[model samples]
Target: MYRILIVDDEPMIRKGLQKLVEQSELPIESLRTAENGVVALQRIGEERPDFLFTDIRMPKMDGLELCARVAEMDADIQVVVISGFGDFEYAQKCVSYGVKEYLLKPVNIKGFQNVLEKLIRTKTKVSSETFVAVTKLEQWASRMEHAVWMLQEAELKGLISEILEELQAYKLKLNRVIDILQEIHTLLHQRLNVRDVYLMQGELELTGAADEQEAWCRFTAAVHGHLEELRAKRKGKLKDPVEEAKQYIETHLAEEVSLEEVADFIGLNPSYFSQLFKQSTQETFVQYRTRRRMEKAKKLLEQPQWRITDISGEVGYADHPHFTKTFKKYEGCLPSEYRQQMGIRT
Candidate 1:
């Protein structure tokens, strides 16, 4: 199903054409009408209709001019020109702008039917290609998720090699590949406690490669490096309860976690765990949690997209004012002031 927009100067013609399209039994999902090319351009921006039925001449911005503008924008919109004239020069102009169909006014029903059928067939073929693209991306995402789990288990060498191989297998466009990797990066933070505060927020801009193959190389290298660091941490000789506690805190930073909860989780008495944590980490549980939250706030401040209030809630302070007060105390400045000093602009 596709959306269609009908553009014309006359209300009667626009309504009539819309009715004809509705009764044509074509695969059109919806129909829209605009009085002139100017309004149609606005409709295109808003609705992004798949097909446009436009008149050649109109009061403000003729169809040819609209087509020219659309071509400059490089959007994937199919256009059919509706004209009162059957002139060869006008048809040539329409062809130059990649108009799919040029229909004469007082449209012949048979010709109109032929055009609709052709459009439906073309769209169906494109839809098939799109389905394949989506399926391939889904497979890539699944592989990346498995890789993250392997990282959590510290399967360092084998998992790293497999991840690089999987990156080579990616069939999607570079931008789509980047989006999937970013999603996986977020999962890495939540699941594996791979918290590079700067990278977690939008501080690190992953540069684009010359092509998909180059992109795969760069992306896999970065992932391999991050995982290697985690693997090193996991390769410690002695089991460290304090480190485990820190990992737990990072994994559940947004949740309402408590000292007793963490202590019980690692099979320790709250009192003894409290004393040990303070001795080892040199910070009380409450103070450590506040430090983690404030550090998270600073990282989030780097991302211009997130609101300060939203970052506050994300770091686990329900009340914005309370988060602000705590952030100021911890960072020696307000969150906004900190962001400004760090040269982050919204």
Candidate 2:
């Protein structure tokens, strides 16, 4: 409900205005009055009314001056001028001060009601429009986030046209969309998890669209196309021993696995496997193992049912102390601290 303040030098005028406003059907919760502009300013500072009705010719501070002061204090408050004099120049000055309405001396009850109703209706309409605009912006942002997630997964085979449509529907600038798509591509190239890569790929496809849905479909198509290309290339390259090593690491993450064991599985010497793994992955075998184990541990930590001790054992760390030390070294925090920081229940 809106709060109202009536400021006038005459006691009778203030009383009449207060009674009339209170009798109105407007959802006004509070009605306050002051005899002069100085007292009105004081009441305003105390209560901060949403609407102000003030006489124009008050001593010390006239209605115009009071309105100006109120604007400086809180521009959101609506001010209406009430004057016994019908001076056109005075009314013009009130308008200049951002007063919504001006009333001549001896207020017309029906006219005043009409003016108030118009003001309330206009305010409501503007607020509703703003809310709708904000909701659409939020939804567009959410769609963009989802698209980015798909792009990161490198799955952009069937979404090209859909992405184009989304861009158009959202009225997104083509250049900005392209920049976001490029960023997602770079992130995918960094070897993020499959989920993240998929998201990035989806976003990239959407960037091509004129609307959100179209962007999504385009992203899916792009991912499929990319996978096809990768498959064709894979046929030409020698069998990836590094890929075999990675698969072995994933399957035996809970076992005391080592490069020697992986080398034996692939029928390669331990020293050769180590060199080949580094050359293929640009990371040492031990670094790769630790990264893989840490990633698994992070996933397990998301489960509230798993204790830190059990998580450590599941990630192939036999000693709890050693697990804590290594976790801290790789993750820059103890396992428990990591879980807390991530808001994981475990």
Candidate 3:
């Protein structure tokens, strides 16, 4: 199966080629079209196609520029230059760009089939070679899944290291390394998805790697980046201690809540919990509790039927004078002054 892009300014020829490819028994998974090289480059950058059927002449950017750019972008794509001109100059430029196949316009039905079959043969050969290691890759991917679940960093690196060593020792194609990395990336995300955590989205299409070693470098970089993301997400997992403490404090607003009790309730040391609470809420726990009590008192004061002393007791302050003092300190006025201003007679 392959994804192919047809790049031509003429809609008729593009559609015709698309129809022919579809009508035939070619293993085309996707067939997309772009009017010119400019559009083609954008599409290819986003999602590289397996085979490219592009005309030499196009507006805005021609096939020459597309071929040159694609060479720099990704060397793995199979590019075929289709031209009506049969121009030697264009053919030379295409060859220089490392395009091996060139078809004249008014493509002979037989020649077109031959070119496709040839590209498919080359593609299938490399693909089958990559598949020979599919079983091992699946086993490795399963191990990677477990390592990520356990948040084992060294294990992940060891797995990738062993894979790279084996790939190099066997002199296998870079596709095998790419496949393993891809499988690991997928498995890691699948595990995260089960946790309802969409940690990151990743794509690892290689630019023109200078050699197999460079390709491996790019692939491993991507693989390790995903691993790093997974580790970060794991560290951020579980219910936050600070949030649970805040909830408990809010619910027990009427009680004389101590930091030690709150810390013990959340299973953390008082000193560390105090520091964490301040860092997260940007306020000391005492300050937060005092403010919350005063807020509750203000609402209680709005009800004219509740006595001022009773309101104080309801907000965790049993002493009326102390409650009034604290309320004035926080709100710039006593609760009685607040009631008076709101025209709630006491």
Per-residue lDDT of model 2, residues 1-346, tens digit only: 7788899999988888887787787898789988878999888656566678888887888888888787665234678788766554775687756787877778878877876886677667644542324344344434443443443333232243444555456443333344344444444433433444232212233332443344344434344434422433435534566797899998998889878899878655465466557767999988888899999888888787899999999989899999999989998999998889878755
Candidate 3 wrongly placed segments (more than 4 Å) = 129-132, 165-179, 188-346
Measured over all alpha carbons after superposition, the RMSD of each candidate to the real structure, in angstroms, is 15.3, 19.1, 13.4
Write the number of the candidate with greater lDDT, choosing between 1 and 2: 1
Each model's backbone clash number: 0, 62, 0
lDDT of candidate 3 over 201-229, digit per residue (tens): 45655543445676666666555545544
Q: Is candidate 1 or candidate 3 better by lDDT?
A: 3
- Candidate with top TM-score is 3
Model 1 lDDT, residue 255, Cα: 83
User: Where does candidate 2 stray beyond 4 Å?
Assistant: 129-346
Q: Write the per-residue lDDT of candidate 1 for residues 196-275, one digit (tens) a residue.
A: 32232111134433445554544454455444334434565245668988999998888889998997776554654675
Ranking by lDDT: 3, 1, 2
